[model samples]
Target: MSSNQAFESAKQEYEQWGINIDEVFKTLKNIPISIHCWQGDDVGGFEVNRGELSGGIDVTGDYPGKARTPEELRADIEKALSLIPGKHRINLHAIYAETDGQVVERDKLEPKHFEKWVTWAKEHRLGLDFNPTLFSHEKAADGLTLAHPDPEIRQYWIDHCKASRKIGEYFGRELGTPCLTNIWIPDGYKDTPSDRLTPRRRLMEALDEIFAEEIDKNYLVDAVESKLFGIGSEAYVVGSHEFYLSYALKNDVNCLLDTGHYHPTEMVSNKISAMLLFFDQLALHVSRPVRWDSDHVVTFDDELKEIAMEIVRNDALDKVMIGLDFFDASINRVAAWTIGTRNMIKALLFALLLPHCQLKELQENGDFTRRLALLEEFKTYPFGVIWNQYCQEMNVPAKESWLQDVQKYEEQVLSKRS
Candidate 1:
């Protein structure tokens, strides 16, 4: 059925259930959402809380599973947003050159490219999940093997960020699309090959310099990514919820929580509580199987779903932004994204109604069983059929057009049985 039809169907469910259909619809009708992402092919348009955002810039917008010429990326964004209109935020992961501070100047993409991207995105109604300085990281367990992590990498990142910020500064002046930047140390290492303390200091010092550099802009910076590991036995700084809050408060950076990136114990709702109590800075990330090495899929389960609903209820929704963070090149990328998003929405709607009672308890007692249940709750997910019923019952548009689409996606994710 079409969106209008689905909306009508949802209205029926609202009435039948003896619940305020309009009230429920109004609550989630067009929620405040953002996505922490992996590589994506659809690019160039804007979708924010307000309306559709048009795409800008051409050539060189590639995330691992996605590679497009800047112009192609520009056009793709326009195409992608047509399917789901309105305000949508997209996270640009570590797409910068790190360690090589000055080498980034050689790229063909000009500041005009960055400026155009930001301007058109803002005018079109999309916010940027921009990491002023981000780079891909691979590990050897013994050391960190980042894309670029030496003097060359440092110079490249420095130039890229400066150039990128020049674009940020330009568009931020007129459109002011509210840019959220999360900078991670894609290459910080332990002190002299064995000293654990060195990595933290070096990484912190590096980011502090970057923040100090970009401090002029009205940007909120998150220091970590979901489970993004570091070189030689150390993970990223914002490992513990408290760690991020402490770092953000001590150094003055915003905590961008990637729920899927946390260790098993840190549930979503509680993570936000820390953000609220400590820094008051909030950011959004969505993924299923909360304990995966690589982001398996952009789906969610019940417990995870409930927490997402709480995220919306927290009224801190505005302080937060949401986005999709998964990719697959072997298959149709757009289809993959649609299903992933559909699963998230399905899980989210269910979570809205239920209570994460144990979540709060676990936060207080550190009980093992609650932790197990929380993990178990989201295991059999991407409940595509259940999600479809939800959208139908709620009078909401179905993000995923078909059940086959849902099944195909469910089969792809290996359950990390919480």
Candidate 2:
């Protein structure tokens, strides 16, 4: 067929799939919604509509952010948790850009920061997903270096993974953090579709080494992450559920779902959510995504929220942890957390509101749009409207730097009027 004919055919197929969003709204009237915590970015171009409601928040800390001062930060976090309805934790996809040391050397700061952070998680009952960027220099590489080629690196991972297991075992004991031992390499191509199979194979080898040893001794830290690109075109990481699972080994492996990593064409359906059940461990990622960009915000709309929560609610999945992958400028902290958490609750509330029979059939049959209008209707409903309300209600301070944005906008408006 001609290109125009192909386009028409595809449109026709999509038209059938498209449901009446209005009708979905009709179904979503006044459903209650809440999220444990979220990283919203309303200050940035990404508007997180949700922070109006019930839930705690997990946004970034400042200048060296809270991670730099784990103790004071942890105490602050624990206080916030106590104040809010629920407080969920988040692991930054990348640690600070300045981390060139192996560990954030306990003695590096005027007062050691690492020990305090360890103390905080231990005291507060917060679970963690440790993600160290491979970009950090040798001392800070967390023992495994991504600088090597696949063949050489595979062995390095094998060796390094042993140390990771030991460290994880210690952390688990010290902090009593349940999940431990996870790793993801940012070693994918920039320009050409470089060593596609090599990195994946090395990743597999590293995991196998960790699993064979770690699983029996203590709970193996679940390896969970998806594919994404930073600079160039080749996004070779595990970008989708189908592809993520395709390479997944049969033993001790778990599924990790990242929201922003997917190609625009990917869809998260009930059936897709069902696949997560196969893993011994599963975790859902929260990140804001637009057409081509992953902004990492909190408030996502109907379709985006639905597919995400369906995976979360699947009873079959074990150790179902939900965490945020927020990537906004450092200044918009409260808004980011508020909006992100609010959207998260909306997702959970969406699941709570659904009729068991209908939801089940929808999951079994993959009838996605059936929930679309209802989901949208949530924005108008008390729950959705309340997310923003809750954010406003919270005494949480806004980012100091972002306050300047208000003055600038006001000045521009006054000038225009004059």
Candidate 3:
């Protein structure tokens, strides 16, 4: 049978279980996954054209055709978006701003620095998200920013974050979508800190100062990201999950969970339901981690599925903000973007197609045997058939045919870059 016929049969089968496949497709179509700009360029923003990786973030492999400028990055992003289904947003760091060959310090950034980005986003009808570049600078060489003991240094980062919020507000105003501005500082010690409390306190005070100016929530959504440890921050990370979670809850802001930022055994999926209970809104940096915080490209793995299930199960899709946070420089950058995003779309669809109500009924009534059996049996269902339908309806290539386009792009566009 043809793929469409197979999907039709799968639809009939799922309907017998009371699953509305059409509603799942409609729901998944409306959700936008924000793709990280760093993936296209290996996190090498074009500020000053340094091209050197820092901020405790490292990208392995010297893959050719890394985007070296804003224009190239956008071109690459456009190509990747072509292969992935669904409407999506673009996440940008302050460092990606087009300064026209001028050195614009992070703290001194303004909406004007990103005016070109706003224009580009408007052209593509893509919502923009913002992040303050908090590391890989002279000031952050010591693995501290907002939590630095020097008030002058801390104030600089505070000013930079405040400026980022304004820029985020500007993007939202121009594009008519709320821009999420996330703050993730790489402040920590390689060894045990003599005083952890002082740095945490300083960070708290700095955050308060940065958020002092009020902006309309409709325009800007502020978030703080936490990490268990970074390369140099193996011994202590000031912005632990507890610290940021408490800060966000108390300050009426959003807490961001980066899957790769936690311990190996601890999954961000488990935290979603618990976080939703306390906060009305939450943010996620979806990425795959090998053993530590290694930002590998996302795949349709169990962890990814569980994260999607938690969001769909709690009916918190609208309340949560989903964004990609992976960069793999070893392979074709555009292919990495397409694969990660398409897999994320598949995971969400898988979650949406599950018979959650029926499973919940079994679990609530202590029918553990059947609940487990159904969960395992549902895994073998014809999910790919529906996924192919989704890709076809969204006008994107499916069944690995998208990789052909990626190869063509590499030959035509990326090969000519260097």
Candidate 4:
């Protein structure tokens, strides 16, 4: 059957469950997923004096055609954005700053360093987000940044974060969209540490210093991310979930939840509702974890669906700031971005199409049997047909047809990168 005919049939099926598919489309188009820029270059930013990847983060595989420059990275991102449906934002790190071959320290970074990025974002009508790079620097060589015991080192990172927030505010002011500036540091000991409280205390003080200057919330939003454990920090991490949860709540800042930053059994989906109860808003770093906090590309798994459902059902779509955060250098870099981001949008679409109110009613009325049956039965619903329709309406290729574009781009553009 033709795609339109298939969609018509699927639309009728969903309509029977009282789902307004038209409304779902309208809502879905407004939800923008912040696509991370690092995926195009495997977290290797364009720093003149670039150092090796450090601070428990690693991007493996020697994938050819990885973006080596800021221009190339932006082009690759453009290609991926063309394939993905809907308008989205680009998330950038401090290391991606362009200093014209001059070695600019992180603390000294200014808005002019990202003029090209702001121009590109304006040209494409895209929003921009920022992150303070707290890893892969000589200062963070020991896997400690803000939490470093040395007063001078902590002050340096604190200054870097303060500078990053200004750049974020610049993007927001120029683009007319509030920028989300997130801070994630890899400061933890490989083994157990006797003085855990001291490092956390130092981190708290550093953060206070970084956020001491009051920037208008209309321009820039601040966030802090927490990690359970990482490559080097197996025993203890200074920015534990509990630490940031309390900090974010007390300080009126957003706490970012990375899907891969928790234990294997602890799901981020389960934490969404609880977080919304206290905070006015929260943020997410959607990623997949394989065994450990391995930054694998996001997949449309149960957890992803549940996460989307939590956002949609709780009516917290505006309250939750969603962004992609994964770097996989094993496959085509552009394809990695396309696949992960498409899956994230797909999960949201799936959540939007569900009869959330009816399901809640069933559960509240103690109709567990019917609820379970209906949930399983809906799994076989014509979700793909609706997704294909979304892609078609968004003027992007539907289904696996987008892969052909990626392949063609690979041959024409990416393969010639080196």
**Residue 102, candidate 3: alpha-carbon lDDT:** 89
The sequence of per-residue lDDT tens digits that candidate 1 reaches over residues 63-133 is 33342343444443443444332346655532321222232332222444455556656666766656543
Ranking by TM-score: 4, 3, 1, 2
Which residue runs does candidate 3 get wrong by more than 4 Å?
49-51
Ranking of all predicted structures according to lDDT, beginning with the best and ending with the worst: 4, 3, 1, 2
> Which prediction has more favorable TM-score, 2 or 4?
4
Number of clashing residue pairs in every model? 46, 28, 0, 0
**TM-scores of the models, in the order given:** 0.64, 0.61, 0.99, 0.99
Tell me the tens digit of each residue's lDDT in model 4 across 141-217. Answer: 99999999888998899999999999999999999999999999999999999999999999999999889999999
Off by over 4 Å in 2: 1-68, 75-83, 90-115, 138-147, 150-161, 175-177, 216-218, 233-244, 269-271, 316-319, 358-418
**TM accuracy, model 3:** 0.99
Q: Candidate 2, which ten residues in sequence have the lowest lDDT sum?
A: 46-55
The 10 consecutive residues of candidate 3 with the worst lDDT sum are 46-55
Clashing pairs in 4: none
lDDT of 3: 0.92
User: Which candidate do you rate higher for lDDT, 3 or 4?
Assistant: 4
Instruction: List runs of model 4 lying over 4 Å from the truth.
Output: none
Better-scoring candidate (lDDT), 2 or 4: 4
What is the C-alpha lDDT profile of model 2 across 148-235, one tens digit per residue? 4544544544454454444445445554544433455445444555466664555665556556663433533665455555433344
Clashes of 2: 28
